[model samples]
Target: MPRDAEDRRLEPFEWNSEESVRYEVAIEVIGEGVAHYSALLNAAEAAGDEPEAARLRAEIGACVEERYRLRATDHEGVTQVLHKYRALLRAPGDHDA
Candidate 1:
């Protein structure tokens, strides 16, 4: 399935400027971390690995905190980036705001 540009995730290079670049990089990194940990958490849960799942959950929480921090300090339109990645971070049967 092809995704529309408006519906796609934000990239670091989409905005130009040193601060914007750094901000975007930080946001993207946090988003990626959340995604990676979420995947691992799912796998661990599927395998009944409680310890690993717990660790991954902590990591995902940290990423979410970082995402919130970045969003707090961002300029206009940063929520667009946040929502894009938040969708990826959300798990099945979970509804977080």
Candidate 2:
């Protein structure tokens, strides 16, 4: 299936906490790979290399699709985190503690 705009905007949190560092690195690598592939595809097209451009374009498309998929999953994860935190905040005993 195709990805939506929201899927493209989901961002991983920073690595200030040890528990999230690995996820941060993975997200960075996927993001960079997508960027690199996209740049190469554009450069090939600009150079009038139709064949090479087509190949690179396909590769970039695949990378972008994967990125979008990851973004969607991340968005869901973020939503869950927000819900969990909100619930904690609303707990009775935690009101002043």
Candidate 3:
């Protein structure tokens, strides 16, 4: 995996208080990896390194697919959170008249 601006590769997603924030971070990670791999792919092509170019191309594809999957998961996570919040709102409390 290509390093991001922070010189870190994509780490496994950790639970965040905010699903939207986590999604944003995951997207940024994918964007960074794709950008780095794109640069490497270009260089490999320029140098006529077919093998490396092929590998970079594959990596880029995987990154894109992962990003797509992450988006769906993020949406579901947000929906689940909203449902829980709504349930709490509907629940009767001791103070309810």
Where does the lowest 10-residue lDDT sum fall in candidate 3? 88-97
Query: How accurate locally, in lDDT, is each candidate?
Result: 0.64, 0.53, 0.61
Global lDDT for candidate 1? 0.64
Candidate 3, which segments miss by more than 4 Å at Cα?
Answer: 1-17, 72-97
Give TM-scores for every candidate, taking all chains together and pairing residue i with residue i: 0.53, 0.46, 0.55
> Which ranking of candidates, highest TM-score first?
3, 1, 2
Worst 10 residues of 2 by lDDT: 88-97
**Candidate 3 overall lDDT versus native:** 0.61
| Tens digit of per-residue lDDT, candidate 1, span 1-97 | 9988534544444445865675676678577767677877889999999988887788788667657655424654465555655565564533232
User: Which pairs clash inside model 3?
Assistant: none
Candidate 2 displacement at residue 20 in angstroms: 2.4
For model 2 the local lDDT of residue 16 reads: 39
Q: Model 2 off-target regions past 4 Å?
A: 1-19, 71-97
